[model samples]
Target: MKVIVGLGNPGRIFRTTRHNLGFRVIDKFRKRNGLPEFKSSKEFNSLLSRGSFNKEKIIALDPKNLIVIHDDLDLPLGKIRVSKAKGAAGHKGVQSIINKLGTKKFFRFRVGILPQQGKPQGVKKFVLKSFTRKEEKIIKRVVEETVEAVEFSLREGLERAMQDYNK
Candidate 1:
């Protein structure tokens, strides 16, 4: 089974925040593909839904497969990054998954939300804040791209998804 995890804090308060981009993408993918609704699962510390892509079993686990998506201070908003076997970069959620999974060999889809200028005054506060109107537009596009990349990854391969989406 192919697992896709979107990383984010769980709850209604964090729904629209920048840090929840991973969760947002997962939801979009679910809807776009007409997958079943995500169900909360404490076992994975995420909202999850199961489906198929190219006849391959695909399971999306929120806060797990999308662990890499976040407000990247290094990359400008709307950028999509794919990596594998990398450190958590100090993200508590990612770190938790690494600890639970006992490995970092999984794929990651990171969506950037930082400004071109640089990180804001407080990193945590900035990530938890709601995106500006302009930022939201960019995020919407990126989320769609992410979903496409995910389908490509499942249909082709992770390497192809990385090469195609990690621009």
Candidate 2:
């Protein structure tokens, strides 16, 4: 089965924050695809669902896919990266999943929220703050793109999704 994991902190406070956009994307997919509601479990820190898209079995991986969607100070906003194996780059959420999963074979659909570069504090602040007015517009576009990328990921393949998105 193809797993789509979106990383973000758990809690109502983090619900609408940019840091949780990945989570939002996954939630969106669940709603759009008519998947089941999110049932919280220790193994999966966040909400979850399971269903198919375009005839492919798509799993709404919670805590399972969280790590892969972590912060990448290396990537700019609007760029989504897919990887099977890599360090957390200091993102606690990602580190948590990697520690729990015991394997990187799963898919991670990472939405870049870190500032383009410079000002090391950007990363520090990103995970804590909400998106700005301007960034909200950009983030909407990125989220839409994320949805498309994910749909394509299932229809196409992980490698193709990587090549197309990890640019």
Candidate 3:
């Protein structure tokens, strides 16, 4: 079963921040695909939903079947990269997953959160701040594209999705 995980901190304050892009994408993907709403699971420390996608039963958390979607500060806004077996690149959320799973042999959909102008000073502060009105427009489009990419990856294959979407 394919297990898709979106990395983001939980809190109302972080709802619209750039760091919550993963959660945003996951919510959109879930709705678009007709998945049920996530329920909080204290045992796993996550909000989870169980459902099938493309006739495949979705369940469990195996490194081989895992796909993590998260924001990346390195790439320019509106860009996405589909990678596998890669390090977290200092993302605490991704690092935490890597630590728990004890392996990096999993797929990742890295959504760009960096602004077009340039990297801002104080990344911690910047990631927590809400996107500007202009930036929000771009983010909305990116989120839709990301959902499509996830669907494509499931329908086609991770390698094909990477070739087509990782531009």
Predictions in order: lDDT: 0.77, 0.69, 0.89
Question: Of 2 and 3, which scores higher on lDDT?
Answer: 3
Which digits, one per residue and each the tens of the lDDT, describe model 3 over residues 9-46?
A: 78999999999999999989889889999888887676
5-32 per-residue lDDT for model 2 (tens digits): 6677788887768678778787777777
State the displacement of the C-alpha of residue 74, model 3, in Å, after optimal TM-score superposition. Answer: 0.3
Please give the clash total of every predicted structure, in order. Answer: 6, 1, 0
Per-residue lDDT, model 3, residue 160, is 94
Q: Scored by Cα lDDT, where does model 1 land?
A: 0.77
Please give the RMSD of candidate 2 to the true structure. Answer: 3.1
Q: Write the per-residue lDDT of candidate 1 for residues 1-167, one digit (tens) a residue.
A: 66777777788999999889888888888898888998988776677788875776766443334334444545678888888888888677777877877888777887788787787788888888988998888988898988888787877887888888775
What overall lDDT, based on C-alpha atoms, would model 2 receive against the true structure?
Answer: 0.69
Q: Which residue window of length 10 is worst by lDDT in model 2?
A: 62-71
Scored by lDDT, the top model is: 3
For candidate 2, give the lDDT of residue 31.
79
User: Model 2: runs farther than 4 Å from truth?
Assistant: 60-68, 116-125
Among these predictions, the greatest TM-score belongs to 3
Error of 3 at 111 (Å): 0.6
In model 1, state the lDDT of residue 22.
Answer: 86
